[model samples]
Target: MKRFALFALFVLVAAVLTSCGLYNSKMASDPADVETVAVVEDAATEQAEETAEPVVAATEEVVEEAKPAEPQIFEPGSFESPDRCKNCHRDIYNDWKESMHAHAWTEKWYQQDFMMAHHETDGATDLLCGACHAPIAARTGQLPPADGSMFDETAKRGISCDFCHTVTGLDQMYNMGHVSEPGNEKKGPRGDGRSLYHGVKFNENHTKADFCGSCHMVIHPANGTHIIDTWQDWKTNWYGEQNITCQDCHMTPTPGVQETPGRAALLGKWRDNMPYHGFVGASSYVQDAMGNKKQAEMAREYLKSAAEMKLAETVAGDGNLALTVEVHNVGAGHKIPTGTTYIRIMWLEVIVTDATGKVVYSSGLVDEKNHVDPDAVFFRVQFRDADGNLTGKSWRAQGIGYDRRIPAKGMDSETYQIALPAKGEYQVSTRLMYRSFTQATLDEAAERTGEEYPPVESVEMAAAQTRVVF
Candidate 1:
């Protein structure tokens, strides 16, 4: 019985191995026949599958490309109407409306000068005074017509809020070469902001000297002659070295330097300090026009701080007095009376008084005809015509024959030597005077406009007094 059981188990194991394919070689003794059966099965399956399959084709995926960024376009309008800003920012708008920026376009003097330049140049206002007086109008293709009717109420206001806020980038330093990227991006001194309007705000660049340089430095487009390079002058001087921005000095109530704390907008967060928009400098004319006494005082203070005068003398045994007067450009970034160099006048006036208060000698004294003494040492720039003739007309100037421009933080000295009869106690005084225009030019301008031009008043930039008892 045990032998029979063992045999049965062995048989069961052999059957299981055959079914699992382990005993295929032993089961298929006729290999050729087995191969024929496999081939027939594969062929029958292929035919069955081919008959049941559909005739659809496989396709490739299609990717969509992204679109490019669009260029920004500015909306055409006037920001001159301070009433619009008053609706939102009442306090700031009130301050601005009372400031000189508001009257920049409508001022009587500016209108007269602009109209004269326009009338004489035959619609050439776009290249001349419009660069400063009506910057927005010129940029928006509204200028070349000084009549103001060509532009709307806002544009006629000159450098308005929308115009300044819309400035996207600067092409060069000065002379209205700024590029306008008009959009929702309101570039300012603060870069960090969240506004509904699609725009960016940066505080650093806007508060720097470069912002003021856009219009302060004027260069002739045709000749490449530097008409005004105030920005460059400041950059090359101590102001740049000290990291002093134009806004640091001009926009502060203290005149020189101070922190201005305020909010940029009503809904904006409060900043410890923000750049003010007063933009006060040495422009008494505009201050008077706007009836702003505080602004005029600020202008006077700026002029007063612009230079320093010193008198040094070397006496000889033969009663010859050699007086050296040094004038230092201390405050202004550009040449002492920078804009419209032809019209700007800067000169040194020396008065020697005896012990009795009688004037012994006087230089740079204006006569009844409003002519400066020819012998005076004048600190001014002279432009030359094509023929090398000195001409007061800046438009006709092709080259600069004499450029005694007072450099930024630079000192210029003039020596006057004269023989005195008998000097007891002499008081020598030196003064640096600045005027808007020459008498001849003002006379011509008055005659052309048939309006009595305002008298040119000289502001004492700096003065020095010394006592010499020999």
Candidate 2:
């Protein structure tokens, strides 16, 4: 009977594996390949630059057939799928289901970018991108040749339970050096908590911010430009000095909550800290468009907590209204609009009106196309390509020309001078606006997909108004 029971369990496991199209992977065995994280940080490194759009299938012509990417192989471990973990971690699983990480692999934006990279580089860039987008497939030999033709269902799960839990170690702060040994024995933060469903070993790296820094601190693969430096910024700031890890804000209920007491396992009693798994980030527009309402709201909440602004000075002088505004990065652990900051947009909009309601001056006016005015004080980085041309092509970025992004706990004092036609009780309104993508990208994507793209989510961080009396 015992033998029969074991055989039945084996059959069930085989069926699940076959149905999910699981395959053998050897990326874990080769630590070197796994460490070459594919983060294409493109910054405009020129004084004068033009806005360049990335080559996308929706806008650009796909004139090449991509050769399949060579699969990076590693020894497959006894890792259980996310569904199996859901048996005990129902709440955590549900939270992760609606997160951007869950859609990291199959999201339309990512798909467009990945396809563009594949076609541009003739499929050579697949594994680099796949290392973060599809770690399961990239490591399991499921995506050899970097093409998506051979991906299994498990690969579509994005950052899966097995891939995260199986991570055994990391090499450095940047890139994708996460070492995973997937299989029945799952590693975690719990020291003594054991599960009948799987084995568990406490991993100290799980408790550190650098653990999350594996894929967060991105660098240019060829030129070594520091593209995404959120981790590094925090490391050198007050937060890191106080030992405030990334998990404190991102993995907990509060954005910067230090820790919370809870049970690490299903049957265990309330112990110390237990991190949540939503893995939230600043991605409301995409998340809402992708039908994750809860995730979108959470993103909005994060943004609302990110910064605070106030109208510092308002004076009528020299036939003009001179005003000063103060914007402080108060809540976020990193800089506002941190990752993929080149594409991310943040700016200031100021409007001045007379007591009679006549418009005196206006900046940051949204055009009919839903784009911010070009001359507004924008907080964004512009990347340049190898030929010293400005472009949004992150994967091909070789230089950063201009980066106006606000840093952690930082403040920006912006002064605006507006010519007053008639300065009689002038009322000035100021606001700090945030959006995921520029209006141009949205329009291009809409034209290419033929599907009605969701509206550009322009969130207001803060607003204030003061009277300018002459």
lDDT of 2 by residue, 1-470 (tens): 00112223223322332232111133222332111111222223232133332322210111121112222245433345677778887767887877777787888877766765655555545655667778877676665455566766777788878888888787555656577766677777765776787787889887888888877866544444556767776887778888988888998655558566766546765767768788877888998898887777878888888888878654546666678888899998777778888778888888888888888888777877676776677777666554454455565555675567677888876787777776478888988888887766655555655656676878888788888777
Q: Could you give candidate 1's per-residue lDDT for residues 154-181 as a string of tens digits?
A: 7767676766766656655555545565
Q: What is the alpha-carbon lDDT for the whole of candidate 2?
A: 0.66
Q: Candidate 2 has what TM-score?
A: 0.82
Error of 1 at 363 (Å): 0.7
The worst-scoring run of ten residues by lDDT in candidate 1 lies at 58-67
- TM-score: which candidate is best? 2
Clashes of 1: 9
- Model 1 alpha-carbon miss at residue 87, Å: 3.0
